[model samples]
Target: MPTITGFDYRRVPVAEDVSLNVAVGGSGSPIVLLHGFPQTHLMWRHVAADLTADHTVIVPDLRGYGDSDKPSGGYAKRVMAADTVALARALGHERFALAGHDRGALVAFRAGLDHPAAITHLACLDVLPTLDMWDVMRGTTAAVGFHLYLMAQPPGLPERLIAGAPDAFFGHFLDLWANDPSAIPPDVRVAYLDACRNAIPSIVADYRASAGIDADHDQADRDAGNRLRMPVTVLQQDWGAALGYDAVALWRAWASDLKHETVTCGHFMAEEAPADIVKSLRALLSR
Candidate 1:
């Protein structure tokens, strides 16, 4: 009930004592789907169902969220990306197509950059890479990302502040970031809120890594001239003009063969536009 229908769920150990809560279904080529912030693998329920008809769909709650293991640290996108590659390998796939939303997209971006041989194709939804994300947010426009700064702090306060009102703190994003709130059903909304309630410290650790380690890793990769060698497709909202930056051009620097499209939906594009997500994933897999 906490997962996609017709899928089998299991805990796959990707690291020493770190197991990911994964939902897998379908057949043919494998494609691992990673979920975003304050949500679980259930975000891919609708898209997974569709992809299952043609793919071996694997959806996992990244180590810190949902029913997955939550350790004190190791939340950097680099570590999470390695976890994902390990998860896919554990699931009997040496290489596969990959897609992710929000926080997961950052992980996916790292995966594609860090594990070029393991990821055949990559798709990122509604997120900019770590360096570009910080670069674009300037002045009052940065207010939209206040949570990033909050959780990016030294840790104690952010976790405590969020834990103080878990529902309100987490629900703020579920409500504010969605163009169509109904895209996330009432039951699913409760599930997301509950997951965030239990993962305050780990979630903050994930964001905190972005502020430090993740950004440093990204900067290093940029400096090294390393790029994603696989075909990549990016789906996002119109964050360019509003944020005062060029989204596609920014992504182009990271990916060589890139297809970037702007979606007029909410931040939760997988739930809000499942068919489009499925179509995009299908195309990426084909490429």
Candidate 2:
């Protein structure tokens, strides 16, 4: 996509083999924003620009996505969380507000749990916790999550299948998950498709790790009675109630200071309902 007009783009090294493609802008308390699948830090373009008036917005394409290096492994959320924390530290922010959408929300959750002191506030958009996600995704409701199962399968098949029709596969979500098709401009849609097409294997590997290592990390946290101590805000699309579970109650178990609310929009809330997202994030940051 076009360059982020007011931002400085850089690749921040987080590990020996991994560096994150990040765009930094704004001023005041930092807010590290992580993008989800089939997209990049470009997904935060509108939101980041709006928040720049009062917050330093750091948007990064999490490892294995966008322009970031796609290592063979290390897609687990915990590892990704470490990348986020290190990215913030690399930028000279010791503690900051954090918000993530979709897969990035998983990383933010892990970051808050694993490095509570580093994240002053947390916001998760449009996802339940990994374990709770699997719990609610059963019977007919699981149908919507077919891609999750497909990507979670053994490596070879997923990589091959996605590579075969990368645009169709990735574009499907961009189409189906948006309440307003116009929200994703034609150029932005093309950018997302191109990025996903080029990063097919690494993208699938990232999802595959979730079924294995990421689940293990979530379960371990539950078993150890770990919870996010920082102020937390969750904005979702009411998937939990529709799927016969209480989303707020599920998130309550994980966050000590929690705010849960449903907003009207498709999965791409950052683009479809950016004003609402910005308002909620500002509230979270203030807390």
Candidate 3:
């Protein structure tokens, strides 16, 4: 896949055995953007480009995605959050704004809660907190998260099934979740599919970690009465109404200075609604 224009890409070591594929660009206050599952840092192309005029935009593929080295383990959000923070620090940023979509949002959530001093502002797109997410998955509603269940199973099965037809499995979400598929260009879609196909096992392991270790970490945080101290913004679909609960209320429990709003777009809001997402990030950064 080709690099984003005006951005320089590199592999930065964030741990003893892990290196992150990061793309850095722009100037001014630093802001690191993290991509979700089934996609790479490319998902942030539009938003990163827009923010580059006023902010130093750092885009990195989460540990198990994109060109990043995919180790078989350490997929927990806490570990992933450490990678993100370390990436920022490696780039000479002691504190920076952070934003993530889907799986990346989960990592950003952990980052904000665990490293409050390092993350000045946090934006999570289209995902509830890990613990709250599992709460909402019930009966028929859980059908929306079939992939999660499939991945959470003991490793071999999910890895085998996904690897059997990686592109079809990964591309299914790209087609189904986007409000307008065209928002993701043809080349971009191909790149995502290609990357996912090559990294099926690590990808499955990443999701698997979420169901097990990530949940444990989230529960521990909740038990400790921990909440995000940074300015928090959650842009999501109205899952609370769909699941018969209060959406904003659930977020309020975790964030003190929170701007929660429902957005009408596909799951890939950063690509589908770049302008709105950019505006939202700017507002969060300003806070």
Candidate 4:
């Protein structure tokens, strides 16, 4: 049993053949933690421990990423968000605070917009809205996210290519995105690699969702003039500032009551700077 400071880690079934490896601890208002791509619920080990003193932390490996069932479909954020909502309700939480990082942030965004009554507060770390994300990048900016283009390609090729060298494929981003490569530690790196290695198809399926189904959702929201109806907090690395984009203005178009800021850190903000993530989440939840 892998142990963190305050949580008892275990696996719980979220759907048939789709159990999520979850870490539940502490006792207070429930706060569900969602992790990004190439990572799992384990990514929230540190943040969950910090919140356990006053919150019942529910950290789950989003479908297809960790110990969860690597289903062939439903990688779209809307479907994934529904899975998380069902997982929370199954665990006896009707309403709770939600926070997610990277790809998980996209799920959080969908959950907030679609199920506003269920999420009390929302926080997204190191990402932009899916539609805004694709709209802003061009040329060299797109190169930083080459995987986006590659994974967006037809399914069979991306799957086979990534599976051929899963470690190298996943490790490339893990290495480049970490401010301190050593911060992840060796054993955790190995664990991350192992999980990523086994999940190539599902991971590709997830990115594929972003390219198609997820895009449709975002476009429909735009067409419907739908905006997030909750207090939304977004902490990102200022890809907008560095790549000549307007981060706040883009988010404002989607979130009516929004507080957006750029943080000086690598993409893995929670793992790289736990204190900062904690402070940011606390502030957002308080508001």
Q: How many residue pairs clash in all the candidates, one count each?
A: 0, 0, 0, 0
TM-score of each: 0.99, 0.98, 0.98, 0.96
lDDT, each prediction: 0.93, 0.90, 0.92, 0.86
Q: Write the residue-wise lDDT of candidate 1 on 22-130 in tens digits.
A: 9999998999999999799999999999988879999999989999999998999999999999999998999999999999999999999889999999999999999
- For residue 111, what is the lDDT in candidate 3? 97
Q: Give the poorly placed runs of model 4, Cα more than 4 Å off.
A: 1-3
Better of 1 and 4 by lDDT: 1
lDDT of 1 at 221: 97
- What is the C-alpha lDDT profile of model 2 across 1-287, one tens digit per residue? 66578999999999999998899999998999988877888888999999999999999888988889999888888899999999999999999989999989999999999999999999999998898888788898799999999999886898888888888999999989899999989988988898888888888887887788888999999999999999999999988768999999999999979999998898999989899999999888878
Per-residue error (Å), model 2, residue 7: 0.4
- Kindly list the per-residue Cα lDDT of model 4 for residues 1-287, writing each as its tens digit: 24456677677776676777777899999999999977877777788889988998999888888778898887899988988888889889999999999999999999998899999999999888888888877877688889988898987999889888889999999999988777677777888899889888888888888988998999999999988888889999978877788898988999888888788888888888888889888888888
Count of clashing pairs, candidate 4: 0
The TM-score of predicted model 4 comes to: 0.96
- C-alpha positional error of residue 12 in candidate 4 after TM-score superposition, expressed in Å: 3.1
Quality of model 4 by C-alpha lDDT: 0.86
Please give the range of 10 consecutive residues that has the lowest summed lDDT in model 4: 1-10
Alpha carbon lDDT of residue 90, candidate 4?
A: 82
Superior candidate under TM-score, 1 versus 4: 1
User: Per-residue CA lDDT of candidate 3, range 117-149, in tens?
Assistant: 999999999998888988888999899899999
